[model samples]
Target: MKIKNIILLLCFITGFNTAFANEGWINILNEGGNNKGILCTPAIQKAIEKASKNGGGTIFFPAGNYLTGPITLKSNITIYLDAGSVLKFSENFDDYLPYVEMRYEGIMMKTFSPLLYAKDAENISIKGRGVIDGQGKAWWNEVYRIESAKGPIPETKYQKMWTEQNKGIVYSPYYQRTIDKKFFRPAFFQAQNCKNILIEGVTFQNSPFWTINPVFCENINITGITIFNPHSPNTDGINPSSCKNVHISNCHISVGDDCITIKSGRDEDGRKYGIPTENVTITNCTMLSGHGGVVIGSEMSGGIKKITISNCVFDGTDRGIRIKSARGRGGVVEDIRVDNVVMKNIKEEAFMMNLFYDKNTVEEPVSERTPIFRNIHISNVTGTNVNKAGTVLGISEMPVQNISFSNINIQATEGFTLNTTDNVEFHDAKITTTLGSSFKIENSNNLILDNVASMKPIANTALIKLTDVSNMMISNNFPMFATDVFIEANGAKTKGIFLKNNVFNNVKKVINKGAALNAGAVVE
Candidate 1:
């Protein structure tokens, strides 16, 4: 093709002027004839470097399968993949050698490079209707081998070890230890400390670790992407860690881990950085077959706030709207709102806030390491065929507070469970369960259950069970038919329980275990 004609064609294809178009289009195939059989890591890296030096342009990948290793992305560059293109990463672990500065499980360390990585860059993007396959089977097999050799993983062992190794420099408990960085796996796409990032219209598969990870980034916009990494370990779809102003929409994610997880950092590293992941919005996404549809950390020690999740669908996930943290990982998770969510076939709880993640049982004094969860509002959510409706398991030292749920409906095998929570309200909630009480409250205070109904009638079970609860107001609730008791309270701490205007039909008793005999307890 003539130079002028080729320039015009490139301009038309990229929808830009001739000068801007020709300068930006660096076709890798033209530079090095689509090296499908050989590893094209060096050639692609050269192309990116050349384009970046020539004032930042687009490195175009035409229709071919380019097998590569880790490729470091440059600033002011866009990786545009053509329709029939596939940038498949090499399976050889040695290719990702010479560990780079990255975060492994929220801990900052020198580790293997991700398939596509950028750090301290600006105006970077990966947009195309093409596929980026991580080819992560080898990585997954290695992890399995390690687990098989290391019998029954301890939950806090690694976190404790990492914290101990990096003590004084970080936080948590002070202990002397050393950590081996060999077990770190690479992510598919990770951009750290980048700004004005855009990722759109791409399909990702077989990630060794998290699919799309943006750490300490700002103004990230990810839209119209599809992530598929079924049955792969740690293949979280999108994990935005310590990022701000992130907007994710129109994405279809089905991964082995959480579909979309918001994080800051892990225990001490998180506290050291102390950068909260805030002002995020996720909408119009489809989540299928993951740990959680939208999760906010088992790793959020750096805090997370001011997030909104709306207009999403979760199908066949283990849980939906999961917020998990541990005792040592102390940070505030608040000001979150979830609305207009629909879920089906959830394997576990539809909504959960678990402060005791990983079975952490270390009894330490209440200090900066005590995690706090409060001010969460959920409305207009519906779920069917879930194993459990929800769980709010907070610690005794710091109870989860000021959570409200309205217009929510769920069908589950077990009902909602709240422990060590305070000032919670559930209004217009219809929870139907095949077994167990519709609501189980334990060691909680100042709860209001208004207009809540148990749709399915189960025999020999109370619709609501309370233990060591205080200052509870249960009003306008519709108890199921054949329920043995509408409300049952036990333990000496169960006091000030007021029940009024509740409809009890076919119930053997209104209050069981002589809970109404307590002082200041009224049932009318």
Candidate 2:
């Protein structure tokens, strides 16, 4: 009987321990003096520190505006802002200039002002329907005013806020601000060298600079998040630099700059580190009024590889899916797949790869061989009011290989302009254009046109122009404007020109230098 009583006592202790471990609710408003209205500056931080010291738990921010600045997240913590809670940054820049180690603007300079920042923390999350607004009016206005005067150079430094002191020499901007440049850095949420981050169900708006930047992090998941910054200049959404295993889904992002950018580093500073950005997936998102729907790099010094984008919408953007890298950026961008997209009112080309952005005539442009964009499977793409149909500007030396376009319909102003590329297959690609030829190919080899058609050209030129090509074959093809069918290859080296199973109404024969072996086969 005594032993039975001892067991009952043990059961009671176990139940009490479990209850104590679960009930760790620490409210910031209750920790300090009666300063209500959701003041989370020092009060909430103190409560969080105290709770973390004891053990880790959820520190709740109830509904209302919580004015805070630079709240660092620690290990084993989950900050759940209850629906209707608004975490706003302090307007004063002095509060954010704590001097941290951060990478900004393709350079590793020092400054302050990331609303929520944490480094090397494990199992951290910023989840809820709350809002983290980086009151960026002051910073935005200053950047606008400076950009007007200086013209296209970044003028802010944001790395000093995280670390103790700044040691590296930053490239000086052309002009200086009257206020401090180091104190004016801007990022809403910047997490570095972290693991296992889950940021979901938040409305992030109006950042001073790039909205969400997570660098060198892993095992990250960002879902159901909306980042909106309608203001101009320096408003990029969610740039994951040098990270691994990232998944961004079910998000609505419409910013002023590039909607989502992937970067390893840029220029000499980025090359010094030599860490490539890899293995990222962005799916099920809607973009409005950004530079590009998904951009790879102009600042890709380290390298970028293995990225997949699926099930997205690009409405009224400059370019739909753009891969932009210059000469100084010596990296390889390969294995990129974009599938199942809908575009409306894209002002520029739906797909563009510019290997020579800022090429100079005097000096050879700083350019890597237009990186191989193969295995890029694009399907079920429907578009309206596109300016340019598509562009494949391969390097002057070697071609961009193994690119396939499947099941695409575009109402464009201009059609495909392909040059110096091979092994490009177009399956059921119908592009309606009002200017230029239906297709223009130059310095190319082994091009297969299967079920490719163009309608009623306005330029009164040939439907398809083949110049300086080799081993060309046209089979089962229809050209609407057969005014100049099969323009002669003046300097082209044709091994065997095969024209078979083709149906042309007004076009009977092509202008060719070689012999048409089977001319009377259809209408001799």
Candidate 3:
């Protein structure tokens, strides 16, 4: 105990601020850090292996509590956590030993070793303002009793060699109950095939699962981070699977599932790891009570491109900008861009694109596993107290094409629903609903409603409600005053309904052909 009397006896018992006693800094209390909290993972893995064998620098963790387990970060490392540090992670499920090769929630094998791990490393970093505690409620109650099969299914040979290397390449009965719960937990920081990664200003809390999980990484930067797992079931916050040039900014997430999620793996092992979670950027973030404040894919099979979400803010999030996949997850979510978002209290759908996310109904024939939500663009978005002011579902043999919504505003209680979507375009949109029809088309086709509007029209519906829709164009709108009908043509494969130069204010009727329309379907 002579590293200056163990830093003057743990700095007079844990006030520990010897101002980082300068020396090319590798001080985890001179590689012994035991202010009596005992199990100091070999003095913080020997101060990150003595700063990766004296080539890299700063493995410092100044003020207190470093109860550890698995902390491995090699190449050119930096894991500095100074201000009243608390890197406590050890819920003790065999101290995360003997199962390594990571990638959970999108399936690759061998688990339990990600309490800050790194693989194929390159200039890695995990920066300051310390907290990083994953005392995750007994690993979410033994993975909720092995995913509700009610406990005890552990038959180890490393769960029979990880069920013969992740069985038949993930087809899902929830991936055989996560290999019979033998891979119950792991991930509260994972960096695989890493390169130039940086996680700045940390806080990260109780997460036995996903909280800053990076896989197949490249140039990554997560800034001003603060994640708090609200309930910790799946606890996802910043999950960048199959990463590419990524950047998430000014963060503050409240998680228990999806507060920033994007994937590119799963299904035929993510199309045999074709590698694509492309050039991403999520800017100015703040989302609370997560379940999706920017979620893409229900495991998109190796394809998710050019994503850019801007100026974000969501409160009490349950859904705000979600793009989910299905039909065996054969991915291609093209050039997505959601800008200037502001959502409030949204507990359902404040803009969501669903390719039938689950309940895989037998509809095969459109090859490559058929899941594609095309060239997305949602701009200047705003939602308030939303329950549902958005739902674009496609899957009548792969539809959901070219989605576009510009300067949109929503106040929901149900409105803005499309089905079997196609070239969707709505510029300067406003959906203020109290119930139905503020644009609720079905079996859609090239839908374009420019300068659209609706001001709480839930009277007798019809502010636009077509069915079996076809190439529709409701030109330059924005003339409201309640409504009884402003176009409501139904089924029988509704024809190219056109309403040019619209300005019909106090509407009582403006076309409501319900009897399976024919004669010029709907024209005003």
Best by TM-score: 1
The lDDT of each candidate is: 0.87, 0.71, 0.83
> Which of the predicted structures, 1 or 3, would earn the higher lDDT when compared with the native?
1
Considering lDDT, where higher is better, how would the candidates rank from best to worst? 1, 3, 2
Task: Give the per-residue Cα lDDT of candidate 1 at 221.
Answer: 98
Runs off by more than 4 Å, candidate 1: 1-22, 33-37, 150-181, 479-484, 505-508, 514-519
Error of 1 at 287 (Å): 0.9
Badly placed stretches (over 4 Å) of model 2 are 1-22, 32-39, 150-184, 361-375, 420-422, 455-459, 471-473, 479-501, 506-524
Weakest 10 consecutive residues of candidate 2 by summed lDDT: 515-524
Per-residue accuracy of model 2 over 57-169 as CA lDDT, tens digit each? 77777787777767888776777777888777777777776556677866675567477888888788888898878777877876556646645455334423333355454
Superposition error at 503 for model 3 (Å): 24
Q: Which lDDT tens digits does candidate 3 get at residues 348-450?
A: 9988898887765668889778889898998998889899988889888999998899988888888888888888899888888888777888988888898
RMSD of each: 4.8, 5.9, 16.7
Highest lDDT against the true fold, candidate: 1
lDDT of 3 at 85: 83
